[model samples]
Target: MNALAIENLSHSFGTRQVLQNVSFTVAEGRMCILLGRNGAGKTTLFSLITGLYYARTGLVRVFDMAMQANPSAALAQMGVVFQLPTLDLDLTAGENLRYHAALHGLPTKLSKARSREELSRLEVLDRIDDRTCALSGGQRRRVEIARALMHGPRLLLLDEPTTGLDVPGRRALEQHVRDLCRERGIAVLWATHFLEEVAADDDVVVLDRGRVCWAGPADRIAPELGVGSVAEAFALLTGSP
Candidate 1:
């Protein structure tokens, strides 16, 4: 079954339209890449899906649960890591995660256990007692991801997740999330502007100026568009020159 489905989603701020009739689906255990250049409305689309704000027009469903009509239930199954770093610097890694667990109504004992498990899986358990500010950039990112999974969410949404990481950090973070998706049967919507992150078999939706300009398996883009690579095809499809 589809883990996420967006139908005819459009959003606007007064006279400026941010997203125009965008639609897509992400199946369970699949990684769907929301590939768009900056300013293409990637974050805006994420906000809508996460119910930060209702879209001017559209329907968003998570595992067949409609966001508008059953918002709480729908959101409960989703884990999101936005473009910005959201962890409190003053809090220890474990504390931040436990706080999130508390918000989700998880018991204190279970929250601690999950926090430890998640951090361990991400190879950052040693930093659990350390303040978030004391962790390195890569380590902090991993903690944020661990925090997102504390509730065992079935769908994960990451918007520009690797923004400030080095090349190695970026690649490592990408692999970690991919592994999580496969192992947990989690559907993931990873939004990014980096062309190198797009793997050949990845399901990609190319957004341009608030619209979906192209979408399909990454490898198919080149072959079908008569281009040599995903980047070339992306440029052609989005008029990127």
Candidate 2:
């Protein structure tokens, strides 16, 4: 079954339309990059998929379960890391993770075990007791990723996950997430405008002015656009050239 599926999704706020007939599917153990400029409806689509806003004209399905009719079951299979930080600076990394586990109704023992496993995988287990305020930006982001995985979600959704980090930090986080997809078979829908984050084999979804303009493999895009590289293709497709 597909990890995520959206059909004919359209949404509007007040009188301004944000998304129009957006549709896509993410396969298991694959990463699909959502590419769009600012105000291109990427965030609006994410909000609709995550149930932050109801879709007026389309259907969203997670792991073959309808999101509107079975929100809890659909959401149980997914984890999300939003564009903004959601951690409490005053709390330690472990504390923050535990709080999330409690909200998910995870038992204490299982929560601690899963937290330790994920933190270790992210290479931040040693910092578990440190207050999040004391951690560096990269370290805090790692902790957030670990927390997102603590519930054993099958699908991961990340919005601009590498936004503030330096080059090395961004690369590290990307590698870690890629490893998660390969090793654990977790499907990922990573929304970012940064073209460098996409890999040649990754699936690409391009949105322009709240509409989907293209969806295919990264390598195919360059050839389809008569360009030498994905960067060049993106510029041409989006009319940024």
Candidate 3:
């Protein structure tokens, strides 16, 4: 089964519709980039998927379990990193991860081991005892990513995870996520407006005005849009000029 599936998802805040029939699927062990500008409804779509808000229409399935009907099962299979930082500034990195693991019912020993593994993978294991507020933006982001993986989720959802990072930091985080897919076989749905974050081999879903304007391999986008580059194709497809 696909790692995640959204069928005809539509949502509205009062009378203002935010998402209109947005639908897509992320295959297991692959990365699918959700590309859209601000106000393109990416966060709204994510909120629905993560059950922060219920969809007024349509369905969301994680690992073949309906999100609304089987929320626990569905959510247990996914990890999420929101755009804004959610870490406790005063807490140590290890403490933060242990807290998340506990919330997921992980045993103390297992949580510690997992936390060590993930933090080491992200190259933040040395900062495990440091207060989160003392870490740099990139280090904190890495800690967040490690915390998200504490529960061993099969699907990962990252919303603009590289926001506010320098060029090298952004590249490092992006490569780390791609490596997670390659090495750990985790399905990832990464939402971002930056074209450079997308690899040529990546699957892509472009949202324009709260709707999917295109969804396919990144390499195919330019040709399909009759443009010479993905950036130009994106501008053309989204009518951004």
RMSD of each: 0.9, 1.0, 0.7
lDDT per residue as tens, model 1, 30-97:
89999998899999999999999886598999999999989999989999998999999999999999
Candidate 3: list runs displaced more than 4 Å: none
For every model shown, what is its TM-score relative to the native structure? 0.98, 0.97, 0.99
In what order do the candidates fall by TM-score, top score first?
3, 1, 2
The sequence of per-residue lDDT tens digits that candidate 2 reaches over residues 138-207 is 9998999999898889999998899899999999999999999999999999999899999988999998
Q: By TM-score, how accurate is candidate 2? A: 0.97
User: Which has the better TM-score: candidate 1, or candidate 3?
Assistant: 3
Tell me how far the alpha carbon of residue 235 in candidate 1 is from the true structure, in angstroms, after superposition: 1.0
The clash count for each model shown is 0, 0, 0
lDDT scores of the candidates, listed in order: 0.93, 0.91, 0.94
Candidate that scores best on TM-score: 3
